[model samples]
Target: MRFVLKHPEQADVEKIESLDSVKGTFTQAGQFQVIIGNDVDLFYNDFADVSGIEGTSKETVKDLAKSNQNALQRLMSNLAEIFSPLIPALITGGLILGFRNILEGVQIQMLGQKIVDGALAFTQNGAPIYNTIVDVSQFWSGVNHFLWLIGEAIFHFLPVGITWSITRKMGTTQILGIVLGITLVSPQLMNAYGVAGAESINTWNFGFAEVQMIGYQAQVLPAMMAGFVLVYLERFFKKVIPNAVSMVFVPLLSIIPAVLVAHVILGPIGWTIGAWISDVVYAGLTSQLRVLFAAIFGFFYSPLVITGLHHMTNAIDLQLTADFGGTLLWPMIAFSNIAQGSAVLGIYLLHRGDKKEEQVSIPAIISAYLGVTEPAMFGINMKYRYPFIAAMIGSSIAAVVSVGLGLMANSIGVGGLPGFLSFNADRWLLFGLIALIAMVVPATLTYMYGKRVEGNE
Candidate 1:
């Protein structure tokens, strides 16, 4: 006799060939599985003599849950691997721009002329602008201009790095990835930044259709989608096409179609999706309910990091930076990082005498303060459940303050104590205030909570 198990919610029946197969599908729909027959042992002789079938079922469910969790962790790990190499370049660019902002945007008064004596001067909007570092020092002015070359290469050509990195991660053709990325941001195309105000965009007129000659500078989604498309195409071609001529035709076929698909279809779709997400997030940040939203987001952000969903914020931040002059979301992320670090610091203080705990907590605290929170989160905070809660509470309060005050960052930068360098010079004081809150609240709460928990124990 064949047995069938019906899922109550899904209303789908699964055919059970044996007890082993049923165990495999035990957790498919829900936590519990029921077998309704006195002849259950007849299905499997090995399980017939087993006395603890209920316990075995529970173990199977736990194993399935663990397997699913491992799968998710692997997915998140791969996603992080794609962007991990780009961090150094992004940080370097952010710091360079921050220094440039100090040089060019800051104003000082000297000798009663609103500037240094005999310095180079310029007029903007009919007002004489002066007293800036670049305005005063010729050497610094040259350095400022030089730094822009590196900055532009980092930000403007970011898609190239992303695509190349994707190909590297996916084990596809890296050279083809570089070529595909270049086509998206070619100088011959109209700059993506100027698309807003321009009266007309250049196009390629091919008798039947005209393709817009637009670039995808600083875009994240288009490059990523296009890179994967290229990877699959290369794989497909290599499988079918004989090895005798695979080298020449595989890359050629893979790149050309991928490029065409990117420009003609995927690029616009990706752009629209990215823009829509940015608009929704921007609306929330600027809306009347922004504080509430920030509170919820801040509290859950560390948890999101644990699940690896926090990686999506990179795309959103890049889109916000492309659409608006700056991103308001990243500063909140920085606050969360600080809050988690502070929680770990509290743990460190409580376990100062224990060398084993000190070895884990010290590095975790430093790593969290430097914008990477997995160490603190998993090693210390998550291990001590109360500390994680304390960090979340602290992050929520700091995020509320950040959104309420309208703090904005010029770009995504270091997300720890040094994160203030990424914010606008005008908002530095406000960022500092929130950073202090992020630190103090989590540490104080964790310390208090830890003491109570220890006392109870």
Candidate 2:
């Protein structure tokens, strides 16, 4: 007789083979065929009854399952998975905003206008200033305005994308998610950005209570919580409703309760939570101890990336950008990226003579510089302990300088050399200086450490 085991174990198979009643046994995958002279039916019955072994309660099994699951890790992983697809859109919008800043924010002295007086000179502080592209050219101004269409879709209505992504990740009805997201940011409701300055908020008056007509807009936490609520409701309705009329009732049952619950309970709670977190982070970035905060954050960022905790920063960055117009935290993150890449560059130089090591190091260096550092980190830096230490030290130094000088990025952008484009126009030079430090310090330290280790060897 052949038997299939749900949770197959080699020890169980060995014990079964050792039985006196068994002649021989053959096993493949989870299935086993035993040649036995004893009664097969009796043995099968006894084995099936083993699950009822004394003193094991359902509560004990539940506790065992809970102990095995790392809830926080799973939550972070899910948040990462949900946000992965949105990164490209966010980067594109950030770069566009940066370009807009350059066109409008930077000022240049018009030397020729100073030479030729009264040539319709534009002056800032009595010096003749050259008109920016947006000022001089109607076409560029129009282009700047045109870019806002994409920016608005990506950032202002970000909740829509977040909800859709959550549905896609959770395997729910995506249309319901989309509709639910739209409700949170619909034009019928007051825009979240405008709520603070408004003299009065509009509300719907029910006989017993009143509901505020406010939108979530760019809020992340509320959309995430609401999306999951919709997902769970959809699943619950699908299970209880009959298949014949499930199409009609499931969506109706799922979306209505989900939407009501979102606006009534989850939305307010999520907003408070998101706002509180943003306030705390913003305070940390601007506090007297900010330099110390930056150093610690920069030093440990690489380790956070290894554990998948780095994904949480995406939400925080977005929140900071929404609340405070920019984020100081992301610049430090970019510096850490550059520092790790520089460490890998040191490894590449050390391994130039070895073709095999060069092949791995070259790609790792390029990837790390482009804002993806996993290759350089795990492949090169982590392999050589000194390189990782050198990177953390470099990153810490750069981050201290960043917070000290009050460096801030307009938005999240490419996280390596190109990251400077995302900085405030006035801080471009400062960002460049910090980037240089991030590169030079890590590379120099790593190379010197490697040479010393080689000499000892």
Clashing pairs in 2: none
Candidate 2 global TM-score = 0.82
Off by over 4 Å in 1: 1-75, 110-130
Q: Any runs in candidate 2 off by more than 4 Å, and if so which?
A: 1-69, 111-130
- Per-residue lDDT, model 2, residue 273, is 95
Q: Alpha carbon lDDT of residue 356, candidate 1? A: 56
Q: Write the per-residue lDDT of candidate 2 for residues 1-457, one digit (tens) a residue.
A: 4544344454365576557655445432223456443476676567558855333353343333333236775566678779998999999989988988877766545522322354666456676666666776699889989988888888889999999999998889899989999999999999999989999989878879988989998899999999999999999989999999999999999899888888889999999999999899888888998988898999999888866789999999998888888889999999999999999898887767875556557777788878998767865687677999999999999999999889989989999888988975778899999999999999999998899899899
Root-mean-square deviation of every model = 11.3, 11.7
Each model's lDDT comes to: 0.81, 0.82
Q: What is the per-residue lDDT of model 1 for residues 347-398, given as tens digits with 9 covering 90 to 100?
A: 8887789765666678778889889887687666876789999999999999
Instruction: Compute the lDDT of residue 428 as modeled in candidate 1.
Output: 88
Q: State the displacement of the C-alpha of residue 417, model 2, in Å, after optimal TM-score superposition.
A: 1.0
